[model samples]
Target: MILQALVDYYQRLLERRTEGLAPFGYSPEKISYEILLSADGGVVQVNDIRDNTGKKPQPRLMNVPQPEKRTVGIKSNFLWDKTSYVLGISATSKRADKEHAAFKSLHQEHLAGTQDAGLKALLAFLEAWTPARFAAPHFSEDMLDANLVFRLDGERTYLHERPAAQALRAQLLASQAEGQPPLAICLVTGEPLPAARLHPAIKGVSGAQSSGASIVSFNQESFASYGKSQGDNAPVSERAAFAYTAVLNHLLRRGEHNRQRLQIGDTSIVFWAEAADAQEAERAELLLADLLDDRPTDEQEAARIRSELEKVQKGRPLADIDPRLQEDTRMYVLGLAPNAARIAIRFWEVGTLGLFARRLAEHAADFHLDPRPWKTAPSAYRVVLATAPQYKDSASMDDAASQLVGELVRAVLTGRPYPRSLLANALMRMRSDGHVSGLRVAICKGILARERRLGINSDKEEIPVSLDKASTHPGYRLGRLFAVLEAVQRLALGKQINATIRDRYYGAASATPALVFPVLLRNAQNHLARLRKDKPAAAAGLEMDIREIVGGLADNFPRSLRIEDQGRFAIGYYHQQQSRFRQEDGADSGNTESTEDHIEETQA
Candidate 1:
């Protein structure tokens, strides 16, 4: 299904020239250097094609013919290859004579008897080529690794771009037609076509080899069954294999202003749609990418996102926003991760374009929380990072983080319940870090709310978006009490203390409150006494708040809390803390007004 969808999308891209998709029998490959040659085989120059603006070389893409299969033995391509083609340098360990003999023979077979000037010049250059003379002054050690393209008589156009090169390529393929793979029923196309012995390597996946990695491969004899070998087990046709691989490589290509791929943890995610209208597909892809981006480039894009989200929320038909998008256009999102020499499929989803947009909007609504100073709707990456241990690098997250991210994205797309581990991990971080961030709180609330709506935990009270003073959950009231105690300490110390009660006892209070709250209340009384001396009214107000929270609890603090209750505890604490900040700001403003009135009376 994945391969067929890719092939369909590839056909759509091919029909539109504006997409810059490579045509059949060719692909966009990065060529780092060009090898210049004269008609008489003299070395003219070696030009570096890499951009110098960045630390690493930025090679531009060239529409070269598909590269031939290279192995340990010496094999020559028709017009373009590495240093072996232009500088007569062989990459194999065979005897120097044998290597040069093979290179000369392959070039003579392809370029001989051709009337084109470029082909004749190229043949002449190869006939006179020798390793010793070629390596004297023009060839350098670094040039050996760079990809080389030939030029005849210092012409501005590359040899591969000349008219004769295409003819030679067609001739070469036609002669080798008898050597093609055996016919088999293609699983992707459901037709009898030549089966690919080996699928092309896939690149742009994070953590994969720089050269590339394979999605389907079988190397060991034990793994093969019923005499099938390599890609024969899957039975994908060569054309279908090329189509799928080409579309994926185009999606993964970098250096573009707006990329179609995103790296989340160890996974490389790519999204596309099979729409009749190419512009509609492009616009939908861009919208999805912008919505999932953690840090959007600017506020204007954010505002645009909000506007589109509102349209989705109102049940607006997709065609109403853009007439090009029909209701049934298929969309695909694939997530891949590196696994040794192969690629692992993390998640795959296929649905209609309208359903995808609606589900994505639902995901945004799920993450919505009270207005946060940091961000309105946190991205999937930020939500995953919230579960990491404090002061630790996110790159060091264990396998659990990778699993959580994959499952989270799947849930958003399919409208399924988030992984149970998500709630557990978020609470674990909050306990260990002694703090709950805005992102973490939002995740907890989203998970718990969904669990309630699904009837998974129907008996428990629904967790609100903010602090609910009227609720009577023991864990929640305890969290509120803890917040009040911390506020008292902050007010008494003028917010300058090195550490407060939260830093020392948050984990203990949330997990084993029965053992910690008795001692905390005693400390809070002393803090209140100090505040009463300087600011009696402020102390009284804090005392009443603490009493109201404790009064709601019917019994002593529970010895321990369940995982669901722990989430409520974190949300309760976060809400209470934010409320305290609001109250403090109001108090400061009232004090300023009172002082202004006193100054006016003194002046009168």
Candidate 2:
């Protein structure tokens, strides 16, 4: 399915006449130098074509004849290769002499009897070039091992781009095909064609080999079966192999700010939309990127995404939001991770654009809070970051985060209950750190809410998005009472103290209220007495709110709270604090909505 989908997309690009895409029988490669040759066979210059916009010199990618996949033997590319093959010199190669010979030999045979001026010039240059040319300072040391292409001294286009060279490419392919036996039925295209012995290299996956790595290969003896070897084990056609790799590498292009690609933890992902209209396909691609990543946005883009999300929340179909949108458009996401000598398929998903739009909207709703914690939608990366240690803020982590990110994205896209570990991890972070941000509380609520909707915990009451004053749940009331006690300490002490009861006892109070609350209450009374003398009205308000919360606890806190209730406890505490902050001057305002003013003043 993966390979077939890629082949189909490659055909789509060709049909659209997409620029910068490599044609069949060729692949896009990073070319760092162009050897300008005179008509007779002498070096004019080794021009550096690398882009210097970034911190380093980055190679420019170009379409060239597909290079040979060499291991230990000396094989040559059609018209371009690294210095070791093209110039017989290298930074590290023991067989530079043999490699240079292979390059010259291949060109000598292929360019024989050529009438094109450009082809003759390239062949003459190869005939006269040698590794010893480096001794006379013919080119810069930086160009020693860099991949190089050829062009006539006065021409702007490379030799491979000349009309005669292209014609020769077609003729050579025909000759090779007529004499070869049918290898097998292509697994990707289902056509009887030549089988690829070694698949093309896939680049741009982070942490993979710099030269590139394979996705389909039988490298070990144990990997083969039924007397088949290498690529015969899977039988992907050479054409299909080239097409898929070309499209994938195009999607994975770096330094172009490719919208179709995003990195989540250690998983490198690429996504695209298949639509009849190219513009419509691009619209869907950009929208999905906004959904998963925190891409830079201006006022207009942010407002547009919000408007679209509002329609989805109101149960409007995608076509209704944008008449040109094809709700049935197919969307594909592929994630890759690095293995030893090959790439691993971390995850692959195919669905309709409408389905994913609805699911992502549902994802936002599940995690929503009354006093929303974020200006933009909370990214999956932020939700997962609540679990990681505090210092690592790169939105990436070790291998464990990679696994969790895959599971998290799958749940959001499929409308399933979030993984149980997600809730546990957030709760554990709150317990240990004692700094419960609105983001962490929101994630806990989302996990529990999804479980209830999916009937995993159907017996439990529906968790409200805000404070539920009438509820009699023990954990809820205890959480509220803890907030009140902490508030009283802040009132009595103001900014004179370095720590409060919250910093000391939040973990114990949430987990085992029975053991922690009685001690907290006794100390709260002394603080209340002091406040009652200095500010009687404030003390009365705290006393009234405290009585209301304690009355529901049956005058006795539970010995221990369940894990589900612990999540509710965090939500309850967050809600009460937010509500108190919503009031004018800490006095009751009869509103649940709060702003950042109170949060900045007290939470810090």
Candidate 3:
């Protein structure tokens, strides 16, 4: 009964699909099978086909008559779909990590068989299976988020059959099953051999006068020398040999039984245990047709389906828009090497893609920042600016200029500097409303090389006004302006300030000439904080420090400045620091020292 049930089930599955069975061949009306023997070489027993009236016999026949006379044992094997089975492993975000945590834990569990067997088998297969890698190894959650993985053996045996075999089997089973003469049935048991399209044979007959070649076949290796002679290669010949042998073995075994004729038209199709000849050739010369259990060959449709499937399984880059940018503006920000990895961090702290686009849109007028050019490359956006052209000459254009200021603030906070080109444009713009202050001039000259790079022509056109205008410009505040200018100057001057000014302001007792001053002004601010909090910090001398400040001035003297010019600059910086300290301390010196007295002594 079980044998008949299995046959019925197989017939139903074959009939359910018609993909590769249609074009090539004739159909078989009846299938006859020889007994399948067990491992012990004895016949394996199974139930027989249902009798008429659709009722199974009460005492199932354990041994249906062996069709070919010689008693044979039963062999049984099960078939399954490739798509129905799955490997139950998943990857989750909470897993420790790739190194000592996640994969290690999983591998250990897999080795122990504690992990699900299906999933483990699938993972092992994946580690060895080269094809379809692009579709596997994606992120998933445990128990909740399940993804399909292919396993070798677990619960059910999944048969990887050729499309033609799968299709032909389905078509024959589709027609109503009647236990008539044309459709004979038999029962057998024992697992089927492992699936393979080809195998080698030990022997075959060779022929001479028959127009057909009667060649005695031998094991695959025997033909190697014959194949490699002054003819084709051994490997190719061996493959052909194996395939022919396998086909012959199947045909001879299945054709052991015979006798069935079902007439559809002038052509009389006979369904029996096996096929005697290739149907196409036999049809041309004979009266009756014999069906064989040979491979049904259809290449194109299978190839097409596989091609489409592969295309659907590939990975693609992610793209989406955020709420911040409503207008159409694209910006590209490039990071420097290691910084590129922290793109997400920058996004969260600053803004999303939309936020960048919106900022560019908002400042379109002043900076004339257009974002269209940076849509790709550098992989992430960093500091890019753009603006609309219409507001190029507006007085409030400086408002768009605030973006530059914000960038500067970020620079100070991060202790990184912007590129020279960006710094130059910012300074030239800032100088527009006022005389460039001493600090601003020094910084702009030092880092940007603005005067050197932009030249006099561009400077006059780019800088809006002099330092006087800058001090009073609405966008400029005193303290921020001073800090920004000092920072730029320190950066421009090879990160060094005059030793005397460094000691006086930053309290560096061992100030050396040419020492790169990383954060002079910042250090000064810290010193001021110490003073304010009444911290026990070493006090900075005002006069001797003033002399060293002059000495340091000589060290930073630009080539363009004459001796007289240097004298004036030294006096200016000294007085500037003094005035700054006085304000910080709120100490009033009613009578200020004469500038002439200080100058005369310095000159002497």
Candidate 4:
């Protein structure tokens, strides 16, 4: 199914002939220099073509002839190759002499009888030129290993772009079917054609080999079934292989300001939309990219994104926002991860564009909280990173965090119960760090609220976005009590203490409340007394607040809490803490630094 869809998309690109897209048997390769040659094969000047607009000189991507799928063997590409093949000099290659010989011989055989000036000159140059000429004043040491192409000295076009060279390329492609694999039924196209012995390389995965990696490969005898070897086991045709790989590369490649790509943890994702109408498909893609990728800086584009997001958040169809998107337009999202020399399928989902937009809408609603933790609606990318250790890179997350990232993303896309591991990771991080920021608490509340709405392994009451001054659940009330105790400590003493009670006892107070709360309560009495002598009004208000929260609970604290209760505890603490700060912030409305979100941690 994946391959068929990819092949169909490739056909769409072919028919459209999208600008800058490479055609069949051709690919966009990075070429650094152009070796200008005279009509008699004498070296003229080596021209640098690398772009210098950025901080460093980057090679320019040019559409050249399809390169060979080289392994450890010595194979040369047509019309273009690196200095090791073109000039027999490289910074690291030890067999430059043999590679240069192979390049010269290959070009000689292909261009022997050509009558065109460009082709004849190129053949003459390859036949007489030696690598020793690289030491000339016109050549520099930095160009020793960079890829180079050929061009006539006085012309404004490359030699490979000449009519004779194009004809030769077409002829070579037509004659490539000799000594092919046996004909078999192609799995991707359902055609009786020659099954490719090897598939093309797929690049752009985060940790894969820079050269490329394979999606379908059978390198070991043990991996084959019933004596079938390599591509014979899968039976994908060469045409199908090229089509699918081409589509993948096109989607994976990044332009100057591309947003179609997103990475979460170790997984690299590419998404697209298709519809009966090509413009509608492009519109859907732009909307999806705006929703999941980086925000645009242009004022008009930003306003459009905001309008679309507002519609989704209100439980309205995304189609209603912009030109009324078609309900039947399809959306495809595929994620790739690296596995040695092969690529692993982390996730793939296909659905209607409207359906995906609605899924994103639900995600926005699920993450909602009182006192928003972020200026923009949080994406699945941020949610996954919240589970990783603070200051650590997402691409190198631990095994559990990496596994949870994919599952949580699937949950958001499919409206599943949000893998129980999500809540577990949130709570675990809170306990380990002794820091319950508003963001983590919002995540906890989101998990508990969404799971209850779905009726999954939960019989708990609805967790509210703000503080509940009248709840009887022990976990909720205890969380409130813990926040109150910490507040008392902060108020009696200023905010300059070395470590507050939260830094000392949050984990134990949440898990084994029976053992920890009694001591906290005793300490709170001393603080209340000290406050009563100095600030009578504030002390009385705090005492009543403590009495009211404790009155909701029964006589004693529970010995321990279940997983759900732990999440509720975090939510309750966040709510009470934020509610307290909001009151203080209101008193000093003119001061922007009155809020306590920054003092907690970066999680906010």
Best by lDDT: 2
After TM-score superposition, what is the CA distance of residue 78 in candidate 3 from its true location, in Å?
Answer: 31
- Per-residue alpha-carbon lDDT of model 4 for 1-604, expressed as tens digits? 8888888988887788865457777777889999888999878988899999989999998888878989899999999999999888898999999999999888888898889888888888887877777785778898978999999889988988888888888888767755676689999989998777888888888889999998999999988999898999999988888888877887888664555677777788888777776788788888888777534567687677777787877877665777657867888888888999999987788998788778877777777777666545655656755665553222225533775666767777787778777788878877876657656776787787788788875565678776788677788888888988988988888766788888898989888999999999999899899888988887898898899998888887899988888888887887777777878766432222213344432231
Candidate 1 has its poorest 10 consecutive residues by lDDT at: 595-604
Summed over model 1, clashes come to: 0
Q: Report the C-alpha lDDT of model 3 over 1-604, residue by residue, as the tens digit.
A: 2222223323332354422121112211111111122322222321122223436222111111111101132211111101111222224323212212223343334334423333344334424422132141232222222212121332222121234333433443233122212311111222221121112221111111111121222235555564432112211222233233322222222122321222111111221111232332122112111111111135563354333222222211112221221222211221111111110111101222233323222221111101111111110011212111113222232233423433432332232343344434424333233222222223332222223233522223232211222222111122222333343333334335573333242212111212323344455555444443443222233222323333333334232332222212222333343344344556554323223222321221
- Alpha-carbon error at 520 in model 2, in Å? 1.9
- 391-509: candidate 2 lDDT, tens digit per residue: 32222355235566767887888898888898888777678767677777887889988888889885467778878998777777788888889889989988886888777888898
Off by over 4 Å in 3: 1-150, 153-358, 368-604
Query: What TM-score, computed on C-alpha atoms, does each candidate reach?
Result: 0.88, 0.91, 0.16, 0.93
- Write the residue-wise lDDT of candidate 1 on 12-36 in tens digits: 7787763546765566777888767
In candidate 1, which residue ranges exceed 4 Å CA deviation? 18-20, 36-46, 52-57, 90-101, 135-142, 154-157, 162-164, 174-177, 306-329, 392-400, 587-604
lDDT scores for all predictions? 0.74, 0.81, 0.26, 0.79
- List the pairs of residues colliding in candidate 4: none
Q: Model 1: how far is 581 from its true place, Å?
A: 0.7
> Model 1, residue 192: displacement in angstroms?
0.6
RMSD of each: 6.5, 3.4, 33.5, 2.9
Pick the winner on TM-score between candidates 1 and 3.
1
Worst 10-residue stretch by lDDT in candidate 3? 372-381
Which regions of candidate 4 fall more than 4 Å away from where they truly are? 153-156, 294-307, 391-400, 587-604
**lDDT order of candidates, best first?**
2, 4, 1, 3
